[model samples]
Target: MPTIVHEFDWPDRIVVGTVGQPGARTFYLQVRGGRRVVSAALEKEQSAILAEKIDEILDELMAGEGNPFSIQATTPVELVDNEPLEMPVDEQFRTGAIGLGWDPATAQVVIEAYPLVVVDEADIELSEDGDGVEAIVVEPEEMLLVRMPVGTARAFAKRTREIVGAGRPLCPRCGDPMDPEGHDCVFPEA
Candidate 1:
């Protein structure tokens, strides 16, 4: 497992962005605080899941009491460095376990990313009585953590959804992503 190189409790900025064009894009989660900045490469699906989970957590929080999710639209969330990531991002590991929660006391959303660890059926064990043993998954070293106010999280969720959704739409014929040059459709109309 790659060690958690860095962890920021309250990053100055956390945002998701793409490097390439729609069809040929590379999604990245970047965090910045003061003079330090770290960017990790992740798959598009991971980006989508991250955004979805964040929204779900925020929605659940708003379900109770007054609407605490009403964040302003013009929240300041500027990306510190806009320069494209160096030729090859070193630690481009697929994201593993992600944790999200709303801290009512601190009034900030907590987001964490762990190194993705694949578990196999053989890894699971059974108890002495043949009853399935509860498999315990220890939390891996966190890739990064962001404890930001509601507005920051809201802006992040909104921008993430937009960035992930900005990809090319699926092709009608083959159900595959269509490129600007057009994809070869297998199910050509007869």
Candidate 2:
């Protein structure tokens, strides 16, 4: 079957938002254009990495000779979006892999997210000779494709970082996340 693509070109809003409380939060990459909205569940680490990489890309462009693309060093003030995620976020799928790219033609950042692939024992088949087991290659049924302008991309990265940092505070002693109740920090013995 052909893969379903939720393509958004220059979406009106795109953001990384959490559903639950800090420690038990679930990260979501949501995109909206017009009345259509798509949300993909993703790990906190994935969200952070995505934002970091995007900023890196933008910074590199900004450092280019003569700053040809006019990449902003920081997110544009007018493009800042502090609003919460759209209500009733219906997650389309759990994101397994994410791809990021730069589109020079449109001066936009392209992001693609693929759903997680799960293999079941039932998917395995016996070989023609019935001697070996053959595994069926599973492919994602749906994916999300979003493209944003440079300024929007920068704003997105900034917002993502803030959302991620809003989570559990770190235990200064061990550099581990501290629980709301308390934290039992472990240290290496000399």
Name the candidate that leads on TM-score: 2
- Put down candidate 1 lDDT per residue, 1-190, tens digits, no spaces: 6556567778877788878788788787877789777777678888888778876777677666676656443434552233444444455455666677877778788877766777676765444544755554544554766788766777777778888888898888777888778678889879
- TM-scores for all predictions: 0.71, 0.90
Task: Please identify model 2 stretches exceeding 4 Å from their true place.
Answer: 121-137, 188-190
Residue lDDT tens for model 2, 1-190: 8899999997999999999998999999999999999999999999999999999999988998998888999889999999999989999999999999999888889999999877687875444437665646666789999999999999999999999999999987798998889887897534
RMSD of 1: 4.4
Best model per lDDT: 2
User: Candidate 1: misplaced stretches above 4 Å?
Assistant: 1-5, 68-93, 118-142
